[model samples]
Target: MNTAKSTLVACCQLAPKIGDLAYNRSLTERAIRSAALRGAQVVVLPELVQSGYLFADRNEALALAETRDGPTLRLWQALARELNLVVVGGFCEHLGGDDLANSAALIDAQGVRAVYRKAHLWDAEKEIFTAGSEAPPVIETVHGRIGMLICYDLEFPEWVRLPALAGADLLCAPVNWPDGPRPQTERPAEVLRVQANASVNRLFIAACDRYGHERGVGWVQGSVIVDADGYPVAGPAEQGGEQILLATLNLAEARNKRISERNDLHRDRRPHLYGMDSSLD
Candidate 1:
């Protein structure tokens, strides 16, 4: 694929009603269209967007889970092809009988390009979903090589680093952050973590977090789009409302991960001295 000169990425913060599949789908579709109208070539939605988070039990989760070719994803695939855009978002995945996973899908004009299962489950999620065993693969696109992670997976440095090392220019993080006590600072700790990850890897990151309360559980709503240098180009959007954060970025900048003449982010790595023996086997 030819490298795109510049891409407009949008992170959509939504408030999906719990268990409202149809309503959530409509909301997501609207958000995608809105982003496309603003010239966004890449759009990301929040984790568990179609089914919503905070399920009552495993059965409830299973009820909302859908197969890879289910209605929601099919609609997204059609939209991607129609709008000529890349869509990355999270959903409850149904892998045959009684098997479910918290997964994210990357769709483009070619349809579903990749799916990333959340490797690290958070809190009660372990009880409702199967944890993924493999790391996500980097997908080549006209805009750039895109990688994906869902919710708590973003908390793990190794998970994010794997994609960067695999030549991913941007990481699309679909998150459902629970409401937590915030410091007096403007940005939430979760947003700060994303910024740190982007700066460390020298890659752009679009973290799309949901807002509002779901089944009595509140969300922090720190959806943001950060540049390759880790500065926020869009937002730490309002804590209680649905919002879309957009940023235009030169994807090639991420490939040049050098801070100065003698410092290259990937080449300067001292993995051999980091205390892990690669030759143990």
Candidate 2:
């Protein structure tokens, strides 16, 4: 466990409107620049950060989707190289001839590194986006080995666990969590869900989220960072403004914490006994 290396990570939590690609792009570029100026080596933005969350209808959603190698990627590549930074964010990918995929992409000092399409679609998503067939891949970078997952994927424990098992040091989640119309009491459940996920996985997690109303759709404004111990080390910006969640991510700490006695949950799991959709039961 080499506790020698550390990297600064930033999560940009901002608001963008649905179908407003130009505005969304500007928002992201500004956030990237801000993060870089703040000395963040790794900067993350919310899911569909390029094109605001358009969950209404399939046709409308697909129209806003862009290809992996499209103009959007090129722009991100240029920015990543110029800033010499790692940029992770979500987008609606246009697959052409097939249905579009809700995808997350990683861009670094080199260029577009790898992409992960959302495997688990939520509610109205099933009608607009096709479920990604490929599994998530962990890519090694200057900072550490990183993995990408879109919004709803973080809710499942195995989604984070499998990647960690494959040597993922950081899990980047680009989310567009909706804000319920109910009282503040209901929001705590969502916050606790992220904390539990981070703690159980013993992995560093960063979530960049969309805020404000888009296409009249309300969103959960807080973008947060959870440490290896499953604690909210940074965010939950409930106040009423855009902000960045900055934190020092020590890759070595993940390994040390995982092996520590404080969390035997990882070591004590019995796969044989809990096989085949056991979580469903």
lDDT of all predictions, in order shown?
Answer: 0.90, 0.79
How well does candidate 2 match the true structure, expressed as C-alpha RMSD?
2.9
The residue pairs in collision within model 2 are 199-230
- Give lDDT tens digits, candidate 1, residues 166-211: 9999999999998777676667889889999999999999999998
The estimated TM-scores of all candidates read 0.96, 0.91
- Candidate 2 per-residue lDDT, tens place, 1-281, comes to 34688888999988877788888888888888998899999988888887777667887887788998876677788889998989998888998875888998999988888989999998888888888867677888888888888888877777767777666778888888887665755544556677777777677888877777766677777677888877877876654457888988786666644444564656656765768355532
At residue 59, candidate 1 shows an lDDT of 96
